[model samples]
Target: MVGKFTVVDGHVHTFASEEVSGKILTSFNKLYNIEFANPGTGTITDVLQNMDSVGIDFTIMANFAPAKIIHKNNSWSIEVGKKYEKLVPLVSFHPDMEEPMDILMEEYMRNGAKGIKFHPMAQGFDPDDNRLESVYKMSAEAAFPIVFHCGRVSNARLNNYADIDMIVPVIKKYPNIPFVLTHMADGNIGDVFKLADMFENVYFDTSIVITGYPPLLKVNEPSWPDNEVVEYVISKVGADRVIFGSDYPWGSPGHDLNRFMEMRIEDRQKSMILGENAIKIFKIKSSI
Candidate 1:
């Protein structure tokens, strides 16, 4: 875990709200007053410090900008990107906004955004909706990967296959846009594997899926072992398409770091899970 080999957390969040003032963990912990100081969310400094402690090199962090704050958050992320080399800023779109697809292509793409993060459940839109087709097309044109929040598999709040199936035609239509399905496409991972096989532009990141519990505690059962799930994803999608993601803030970074250390995956596979896969997928050249 020393030398140039360490974990790279791909998905992280910064609560850059006026209420929190971008102090990630401290503000959240203060709000909750938890003694452990390990509630997933952390300030940028906290995140960086935790990474150093755990041998994590970088964390690709993103912030949410609803319609009103979209411009400001985007600006803040750009400035934050300038300040923190380890924090790779990501752009997000809430389909509810006016002409969000057009805005993403024309304005935000020109900004320092490396990718697009969409949450259908939070945003209240179907991935397969005809309106989002234009947005997907714009992503293809921009060559920016779309990191989507895939819903659950069974008795889930969002139907996994149904939500993603809506976008199958888009994958077929835009064969070159790099689309990354996070969290192993919720629970219906087999269907996500099919998408990866069917679409050359698609990739899936192994995030909170490998981590044991929390938020998805009821969902992440004992039967779903980390080694088994990671092995299955690598087998189906190949090592290259599978990238590492801690899902920090919302996900348990410390617990996941421990689990990753404990997992039986080989050193080479672990390297792929940590950072190598992301290098290939995101075309990120230099190490952090």
Candidate 2:
């Protein structure tokens, strides 16, 4: 895999149908005024083919949906994981969902769910809400990693929901559970370092921040980090705590992996960020 290195995309979004995937892309395009990259239509078939193209041995499914349909979305994710060994599913949770957190956790964990994904902005819940205490407790007890869509989202109005300060309490309360702040905390480099320094269990995922969506290159907005910035983050956070993620359907796995592989970091560091750290953090049984 990738010439002596096992590669795992630690963060990816998948949809059960292309219609849903297209709607998501459309929404993002409208919100950001940019045509986000669509590497594989967010379907399992497309994701598998994209992974094969880049030698991505495994990918953590970090799909999230509206509260009304979260159960169905997560159920699809779990079933997909069972059917496809290479796809590891992380179920989603929203405090507003009718089903209690305990019931959802029991069902999801029993059905082979690897972890949890929380998009506070998309799910419309504050990360530090009192309602999420049980979620944190269960995750800590089970040592299940929780991936958060940290930093700004396309809708600036909802950015406050995922602010780094909002999740600090939960991170402090559950020191044992792994908390992966995706998008390199959305390029909040100082805050990223502060969290990494303070909490040993806190990790970062390099998704859109490592290599910006290709389509956005012509846009005036700041997108991804330069090579120097990427290397600086790796040095500051250590490769052991940074994981590779394509943010597929929005960012291409092939392009992101190529950009990542070209970084000046050492081979061991690359190996760790590309796959080893993911296996250790997610408890993925590597077939590579």
Choose the strongest candidate by TM-score.
2
lDDT of 2 by residue, 1-288 (tens): 788899999889888788978988888667755454555688888899888888989989998888898999999999999999999999988878888988889899999999999988767788888887888899999899999988665324455788788888889999999999998887788888899999999999987777645664444233455798889878988999999897887777787778877889999999999999889988998756
Q: Each candidate: RMSD to true structure?
A: 4.6, 1.7
Model 2 clashing residue pairs (backbone)? none
Candidate 1 Cα deviation (angstroms), residue 287: 4.2
